[model samples]
Target: MKSNFRHIGLAKLCGWFGISRQAYYQYNWETISSTLEEEMVLMQVRDIRSRHRRMGTRKLYEILHPFLLENQIKIGRDGLFDLLSANHLLVRRRKRRIQTTNSYHRLRKYPNLIREMIPTAINQIWVSDITYWKLGEIHLYISFITDVYSHKIVGYHVG
Candidate 1:
């Protein structure tokens, strides 16, 4: 079929395909360029992920932006996302459980006093919370007490 079509002119071939000759050439160029760009982006992504395994798509796009500019490649955030997704290169967010407040601790749990209480002034009620922070390979727990009225961090201790 391709051999038979070779006898016809390019204009007629494009016309039969419901496209202009210029469109056919343009589409061909775009496909080739996109494939090349995808390859380049994937290579860079793999290299970066080697060191930073948990990097998200937004950060990857930022890193790729300047690299793309240097390599004369053009791709948007969504395009990069789709490319990464299609290639199975997109990182999955891990649901890490950091036990800040142990529910099963032997100590008796305190009642929620703040549920019914409203603060009218600063330091009237200090709400305390424990949150985990990741610094390099170490996991640190931050215990903070915030003033309910002012919504300011009154005191914080990191362990």
Candidate 2:
């Protein structure tokens, strides 16, 4: 691969780079070996995805962790993500609404009296929101409570 870099032979290129020709060949071999490793990992991922189509990268790394350890493959979660992205194997994420608020309920809707009012004390007003995080083929729902004045997360729970 280095030969086509220019009209010059790899030997001359190696000389110009001030490195041995063996080093150049070794570098190419290492690149090939690394590419092969990634390809192997991709194969395993495809096999896993056949059964679990919507798996996300984090869980993929967790499942592959044992296999990678057993096979002497050194790859991190981000590296695997990059590889999956390069191969167009990465799963696309979709947002889902959990209907945290039911507008059609019989209870009266409360008006925002404090909409423009700033909280004077930490406990004067507390705001709560629901956050959704995608995990593999599942979605994790977390609710958090924050003190309006302090802007601090006082409590959180995952459902």
Model 2 CA RMSD to the hidden true structure, in angstroms: 8.4
lDDT of 2: 0.90
lDDT of each: 0.88, 0.90
After superposition, candidate 1 runs with Cα above 4 Å error: 1-6, 98-159
Clashing pairs in 1: none
After best superposition, candidate 2 residue 15: deviation in angstroms? 1.2
* Candidate 1 lDDT, 66-154, residue by residue in tens: 89999988789998889889999888888987645558878878889789888888988998888887889998988999998999999
Give residue 131's lDDT in candidate 1 (0 to 100). Answer: 87
Candidate 1 local distance difference test against the native: 0.88
Maximum-lDDT candidate? 2
Query: Model 2 off-target regions past 4 Å?
Result: 1-9, 98-159
Q: What is the lDDT for 62 in model 2? A: 96
